[model samples]
Every structure is written in structure tokens, then in C-alpha cells.
Target: MSNIASILNESEPAAKPAVEAGDAPAWNSTPTTIGFGSVGRMGSGAAAEPPKDADAAAAEPTKGDASAATNSKEDGPSATVPGSAAKIASGDIPVVINEEDMEGQIYSNAAWKDLGISDEIHRGLLSENYLRPSKIQARSLPLMLSDPPKNMVAQSQSGTGKTVAFLTATLSRVDFSKPEQPQALILAPTQELADQISRNIHSIGRFVKNLKVALAIPRKIARGENVNSCIVVGTPGTVLDLGRRKQLDCSQLKVLVLDEADNMLDLNGLGDQCLRVKLRIMPPDVIESVQVLLFSATFPPKVQQWIPRFAPNANTLTLKTKELTVRGISQMFVDCPNDDSRYDILCKLYGLMTIGQSVIFVRTRKSATEIQRRMTEDGHRVTVLHGDFDSTERLELLGQFRAGETKVLVTTNVLSRGIDVASVSMVINYDIPTKPGPQGDEPDAETYLHRIGRTGRFGRIGVSISFVFDQRSFDHLNAITTHFGIDLVKLPTNDWDEAEELVKQVIKKNSAQASYVPKVDDRQTEADDSKPEPAEAASQSTTSTKKEDDKPADVGW
Candidate 1:
């Protein structure tokens, strides 16, 4: 066994290893350990040692601090400790850990046993191959599962374990004795996200006796049908209508979660409906009993300031703007000769690397359809999804992508956020994400972040390639890179052989450095006099030229 694996095995009881020796090679194959020691020691009566590496150390529980380590045990299982294993094992949440608390501390990820999670739930997680908590889950789960559930405003990079973190909390809070009583509510920005979360809840809570979860998206539930499931996941508008008609009970709701909260709260339509649902649940009598949790990868400055007002006095855990981008994602740009060449360049990408599943983001439904057709002609199993599709069709298309029946998904902004597909190894930004700006249209930094975040989930390596066809597109891409302080390497389109070599090198370097700070070229000018019109104008022209296209010009999520 590897040293790290042995350390992980130390916490398991002598008689029962987490997985048998025959299965260890596949189950514990990763070179490094992530919070496994803390999990192993939970019920085996073993002591966890300090981690040897920084990542493992960050996730390991604190050690050697006698006072901090014993504080929770002395006060019983419900007392909080600043930096101690006792706090984790007792199910007490640590509020904040300052520099002083770091002395001789382990400060690693929380183990499942430390959180006092039920064995059944643990079995479900294990069955799904979730051996340990991700960074976000380790920090947020304890606080979320505490005695008096505290409101949480958590921000982590995309592909990290935000969905699982919130779902774990939701499952833990439900009272299975009354399986028909709705005890938890989860709101997502789109119907796809809601459906995805619902499926995840059912999978994770499968072993929870009598557990029931209902989806409240449009057409999924019929009119006048009451939602008596223990957990309800849906979009804001549908959930609001259900509550208004008394089909969904709010009086017994214990936890309210907002997935992709930044987008949910920023959009006018979604924001209003979300507030209405919250108001219905926060009646004067039960105001203090309900817990609110907000989660997303990015929270703009404006949204950050407004979140506290939405979830008052909430405990916050956020990443700095520079850290918002996932380091594991290798970001690069393909310099195409012109608009016509972009198609050929895009097709060549598949040959350059081994991609498990890929998503191509275009600006309009027309482009999405065209790309789907071209890619299909090139022998790719593709699915096209956009706002033009009805809810049912959209669900079916996404289901195909999730099940790996379709290897390539061509879509607009609808699939940009809160959609988790474990096998997505590459994301192609066919057109940079943009929004209507005072100066025609401009790059959308947040959407760009969320778009690429669709890949590289759960510590897997991911690649994001943007095609820059003209000076305008190049400028927009530059703005996005500058806004996020990203080091986006440029790929040469003239030579396929050379481009493949460079891409491999870039990915390898990025894995080791975890920093992409390309040196700035002071001579680069922003003179757009010779550049083509903005992408939005190009999209409009495409729509007008292809008048036979049934999709609308503004068709997008």
C-alpha cells in the first residue's frame, strides 16, 4: 500500500477496512489522501496522524492541541471547538479559525464519522464512490448540520462539491418518520438544475428509509396535486405557485437552499419569485426555525453586498475573485483565421485530445443548431438544447447528455451554471459569453467562469478552449482573461501537430504550477477600427441571413 493509503487505512477498524484489499487499488487509487484519516478514526477508536502534504494537511483535522482537541468531548458531542477533532467527531460546527488556532493543528477536511452522519447515508456515499469530502463540503457541512442550523453563504469554485454539500445537509435535516411531510426546500435557477438536484437527492438519500423527494418544475407536477414528499426541489416560480395554492406545505419547512444563488438573486424574475417563496416560509411564528443556505461559484461585488439582506446574519465562506477560477482547468484560446475557419478548427480539437464528454457553448439557437448539424455530419453523437425547446424536450435532451448517450452537447447560456456532469473533460466556448451592454454588448465575466466550470469537477483535469475569429472576439476574450487575472495561453491554428504539442505542455505546466499568469504585452493595442462588428451583431446577421431558421433571434436561457 502507498504511504497515504496506509495513513487512510489506519483509521479503519482492524476487522473492517472501508474497502477490501482487492477493491483498494480501484477505490483508493489517487496518489493523495483527502480527509480520509479523520473519517477512518471516527468509530474505529484510532488516532489520526498529521498529514504529510499541504492538500491533505488542509483537509485533515487539527492535532496536538490538547485544549482544542478535548474541548468538544468534555462539553459532550454538541459543543464547538475552534481547531480540534473533538469538535468534528461530536458534530459541533467550528465558527472561524484564526491564525492563533493554527498552532500544531491539522486543519484537514472533515470525515463522515466526525460529522456523525448516519451509516446508511455513509453507505450511499460509499456506493457512489464518494470516499471523502471536498474542500467546500468539509468547511460547510459541520456548520450546516449543527444543532441550531445556521444560515450559510458559501462560495466555492465550480466542479467542487457544492451540490453534494447542500444535499447532504438537506437529507440530514429531514424527519423520515413523517415521510409525507415536506421538511426541506431547494430552489434552483433553471428547470434543468432543479431536475438534476432532485435526481441527486434521490440517489444520495436512497437508503434513508421512507425518503421521498418531489420535483416542482413546470409540467413535472400536475395542478392541484399536493407535494407531500419529505424534500422538495424546484424552480422559484413553480415552487411559489405550489405554495400559493396550498399544494406544498411551508409551515414544516426546516431548510431552504438556493443553488446558483448569485444568478437566482441577480435576475429580476427569479429574484422576485425566490423572495416570495422565502416570505411564505418565514412567517412570524416560525421565522427562527427555518435555515437558509446560499451557494454558488461566483458572487459579484453587488450580489455579495445584497446577499446578507436576503439571508440575514448568515455565516459566510467565500473565495477571492482571483481564486474564483478553477486551477485544475487549463484555459486556452484558438486563434482562427476567420469566421468560416472556426468550424474546421473546432472539429480538429476532438482529434488532439481524448475527451470523455464535451459541451460547446454558442451565442444563439441558430448557431447551436448549425453546430449540432455540422458536428453530427462529422460523426459525432450530438444534442442541441436551448430556450426554444419546451421543458419536456429540454429534460430529455439533457438526460441524454447526462447518461453519456450523447457525447457532445451544443447549447446556449442555459447549461452554463449548476449543471454537474462528472465525465465532462472539455468545454468549447465557440462564442464568448456576452450580455447587452451600454456599448452594444460586452464580455460577461461571471457567465464565462460558470461556463468553463462545467468541467474539471471533483479534482479532475479539464480544458477550456475559446475560438477567437476576429479582432473584436480577441478583445472580448482578453477582457475576460484580464478581469479574472487568468493566464490564457494562445494556440496556433496553422499547424495541427504543433498545436497539439503546445496544448499538452500547457496542461502539464498548469497542473504543476496551479497559476496561469502570462506576462502582459504592453504593445498590444485595443484599436478596433479594423475589427469586425461585435458578436451580437454577427449573431443578428446570421439570424437574418438564415431566415428559414425557426428559432428566435433572442432565443437563450
Candidate 2:
């Protein structure tokens, strides 16, 4: 366990003050506050505060060699802003990009100039303090920015600058001369993600002349009004509605992006809506010239099989299964005596760790409401967000969280993907995420990855603790670990003092260990030489042989 106290006490660079509403540069018509919501602003559109290891003076080595330097900065109070890329751990972790002809190609860190980015876009990147391209950016930029545009299906772990990679491509493809003409479209599963994407585009493309971005989400675009912007970012349903109404002209669209492709393409997820937008909204003629790009952290085997048809003749860029779990986050699990005791354990965690801001993921809206109520009563600044909230309320709650008005957010899985707040240091799985299956219920490893991924952004230290009170929940968690080849350290709830010390030790040990190694133990390693694919694991039911130790009398808190 890394010393939570020490982690909290570490000094971090001073973050610039949050930019006021309507503070955006002259060229960008979208307000700076559009994506983050109307609440207490957290940070300016400037880049996120980089950790010491990601300092500008740090040297980036050639590809294929991993740098062992770890981020020494902590996600403190001032670091709660979003947008911009502090991704790839400053070249500390090496990323492997798998392509057809370029299988297992390693990419070295390169400057923005290397990509032949326009001077306007280059000035924008420099304004955001983005010095060099991340691994994904270095590899995918050329493929996306080729003479004749190319379609691409790209995957990298969360927080490795995927948003920035595609945004750069989208911006570069846009014809700025006709500012009101829609030239690019970026679709996300949720409005929150769409807003975040909008902010990033503004931050990175700040200097591009006549850059107008319109939010295709509800209330942003009036009924029957044309979506007259160079780039449109919105949810699939809203975007589809606009297109069907003939408000969003697609004849000139040069690029189409699915920010989180796995969820967008999943039959059980948002696949149908996304498919409609592709087939019905954009005519075949418009779809032909549009460069389709799909990007996400994790792409399941089933989704991967069908991605080519979605973006025909597209180049593929992916990481192996073993490299899915983020090396920056410390994964752990808590064994509780019963469901009732889980809340008590949850309350105690805030006192034990040095968390900047935390997110607790529950199974349902009722659970989220209950946790928020109980935590608020206990003197914690907490807020609850779930699907029950209307679009405006959801946006407001998220804005409050980003503004740091609420230190803890209790929510359902609606927020599990593509919401980035750099100051999120802790993520708690109040109830393990599970999807209903033919057998009964199966662990959703993809959701699990996205849930924890919220905390460990931009190579900063992050901690995830999953609570399991029964045999079934424990079994589901175990299945998830096996699926991802990750080892979750077990934390005893019987003794708070002992548990705290153990956490510190775990963090210390993991921080000291080399990067990119899955935390699988030796005993678990021999049992299965081959692991099931994500698609198979979602349907497979399995039990864990591990048993919990006897509970003891608790020491005084």
C-alpha cells in the first residue's frame, strides 16, 4: 500500500484558475463552459497539470523501450480540471500498436510538427501545453491524416489521449473556409462525454480560425434548426433526429467518429441507435467520402469482428488483452461480513486514504440515492447522479462535481465511460457491476475496466476498491480478475488499522513494481494457461475457490 498520507502530502504544480464562462477564444463559437456544465468552474481550458515525470524537460526515448519513471505529483485540490492530454505517462510506459501490415509496431514519442499538422492546429496544441504526441497519437495521426483520408478502428487503454488523437484528425480534416458547413461529426454514448469532447476540441483547436462547434445534444440545438458548425459533437439519438429532420446536412461531412465504439456497437448497448445514424441519417454518398473512425479503450472480440464492416477497409490499431488493465491504478477488493456492513466500510474509507475526489459506483438508482443520503448525513460532501435525472439535472450534477463543489459523486453505471476529471484519485465499486446472462449473472469486465479507469488518468496514481459481501459477488469479481489477468489485493474489513496499513503497503509495493505487468499470482497462473476472450467471459459463469478468513474484533477507529 503506498502511503496514502504521503501520496496526499506530495506537492503538485499550481493549476491555473478556471476560465470564466464565455472565456473561449474568438474563433471558437462554443462557450468554454459548454461541456463542463454551468457550475463552479474548476480549471481553465489550458492543459491539465502534468506530473513531475511528465515535465517538459523529460526526455522521451525511442519506441519499444519502457521508461520506469513514475508520476510523483498528486491529484490535489487544484488539479480537478478536465480537457487536454497528459496521457501516456510521459513515455514511462511503452504502448504496442497492432496493425495488419505493421503488426506489433512500437511508436516513439514525436512532436506535433512530425504529423504535418497545420500551423493553426500546431499553435492550438502549443497553447494547451501539449508538447509531444502520445503513443496512440504518434501512431494513428499519420493513418488518419493521409493524403486521401483513411478510416480507422483504433483501441488503446483509457486516458492514453484517445480523445486528443481523433480530435486532431477531425479538426485537420475540417474545411475552415465554410465555417458553418458541418465537416466532421463526433458521437459519444452520453451527453456528458459529448460535452467533454466538445471542451477538448475547443482546447486543442483554440487557435484555428473560424472553428465553430455545435453540440447536437438536447436543448443545445433548437427544433428544426440547422446544425451549422464545422464540427458537431453529440449523442447518437439527438444527432440522428437532427439528420432525419434534414437539419444536419451531411453532404460535406469528411469525418465521422464514434468516441467509445465498443458501447456504440454493442447490440445490448447503443448499437442499434448508432447503426441507424450510419445507415439512415447519412446517405450512402455522404458515407462514402466520410472517414469513419472508431476509438475506445477496450474493444471486445465480438465487436472487433464487426468493426470492419462499420468502417470498411479501415486500418486497425489495438493493444493486446494482457495490456488492458491500467498500470497506474492500484486495484484492490474489500471483503465485508454482510450487505449492511458494506456502508460502514465505505464511510471509513475516506478517513483512511488521501482522496482528492472520489466516485462510488452502485448497481441502481436507489442504491445511489441511499449512499448519497447516508454519506451526506455523515458530513461528507456528496452528490448522486443516475439515469433518473433529466438531461439538464445530469449536466448540472456533473458540472458541480467537476467544479469540486462536491467531493464525492455516487452514481450508477451511466457515468462509467469517457468522463475525465484529472483530480479523481479514488474509485469505489460499492456493488460489483454485473450483466444478466442466460445462466444468471456474469461479470462485466469491460465495464469494470472503464469504472476504475476514471481515477487513474494521465499516469497519475489511482486506487480502486471493489466491495463484495457475498459468495456470488466475490465469484463475479474473481471472474473479472481472471478475465483481465489482474490480481486484486484482498483487504480485511475486520480491522481498520491493519487494513489501512495493508493498503499503504500495497500502494507502496505496486508503485515500486515495474510498469505494465498484470497482477496475476502464481497459484492462479497455473490453473488456466489460456484466458477466455471478453465476449466469452461475459457469458461464462464461474466460482472462486478463495475463501475469506474469520472476522476478528475491530480495533478502535
Clash count, one per candidate: 7, 8
- Name the weakest run of 10 consecutive residues (lDDT summed) in model 1: 537-546
RMSD of 2: 19.7
lDDT of 1 by residue, 170-231 (tens): 88888899999988999887777777788777777878899998998887889999998999
What lDDT score is found at residue 223 in candidate 2?
93
Return the TM-score for candidate 1, rounded to 2 decimals: 0.72
lDDT of each structure? 0.60, 0.62
Badly placed stretches (over 4 Å) of model 2 are 1-108, 502-557
lDDT score at residue 396, model 1, on the 0-100 scale = 90
lDDT of 2 by residue, 381-497 (tens): 778887777778988988888787877888777787745666677789998888768897788877888888886665556788998777677657755665555656666556779
Off by over 4 Å in 1: 1-94, 97-108, 280-282, 377-381, 504-557
